[model samples]
Target: DDMTDPVADSARSLLDGHVVLSRKLAELGHYPAVDPLASVSRLMNSVVSKEHLLASQRFKAIYATYQGAEDMINIGALAPGANRRIDRAVSLIDRVNEFLLQPIGQRCEFQQTVKWLLDITKSWDFLLPAEQDLPPEVPAGPNEADA
Candidate 1:
């Protein structure tokens, strides 16, 4: 009973923090409005939720794989397939910061912190190799097909 108690408590805490943070982020503005803090806050909640689910082993193997992918993104671990997702997430956050936070109008200090967090995430050493230079697969010749 004691063993499960801590897990349950931790899960509860993460969930509570996620919910509170989500609500606070939502109160700032509407979606697609390019609010960096709001976007980063939402992403952070998603990362925490996925991590909690992975830790609890509550999902199917496929779901766990997806969670692992998200974890790589959240933690900025480099791997072959995970880079695109991580890059996309970082790019979105970056755009939000550039468009919304960098301007003089309607500034928020929280937005600056979010940008810093994003920079740290993007700078992680686990980044995957660039995909642009991958060697193209040659078509199998007619004789090669028989082998």
Candidate 2:
């Protein structure tokens, strides 16, 4: 529980703290007509909200796919598939890191960069443990008892 996954944790931190936050800030500047002060205030409030904090925790847990974690999927059981997915995730993160290293205001390809970040996060959901992978319960079924 107290253990740390340096690789995954670092990647998650960079993605959340650097990539995501930076993108949000950049978006606020895209349109000059919007009140900068209000936009920034709203953004700051959302960042500190309970919902955002909980989501950040969930994201960190998902990204921390290290082996031997009790709540995590058994990496050994799905080594080949897991490794492939992790590699892709790391590659996308690396690309983001590289893009961030560029001089400020010089970065382009916003759509592609955003797409990569979205893809990376979306893919992590698949690597969750089997129990967590189950679809949400529904009331509709063959019979009320089955529901």
Q: What's the true lDDT of residue 127 in model 1? A: 32
Poorest 10 consecutive residues by lDDT, candidate 1:
55-64
lDDT of 1 by residue, 1-147 (tens): 232478756865565332212333346553323422212133444555453433222212222233446566666575554344444444444433343333336556755554544443442333346563244567999999999
Compared with the true structure, model 1 gives a TM-score of 0.23
* Prediction RMSDs, each to the true structure: 13.9, 14.4
TM-score of each: 0.23, 0.27
Top candidate, metric TM-score: 2
Q: Candidate 2: give the clashing pairs.
A: none
Question: Any idea what lDDT model 1 has?
Answer: 0.41
For each candidate, what is the lDDT?
0.41, 0.41
RMSD of 2: 14.4
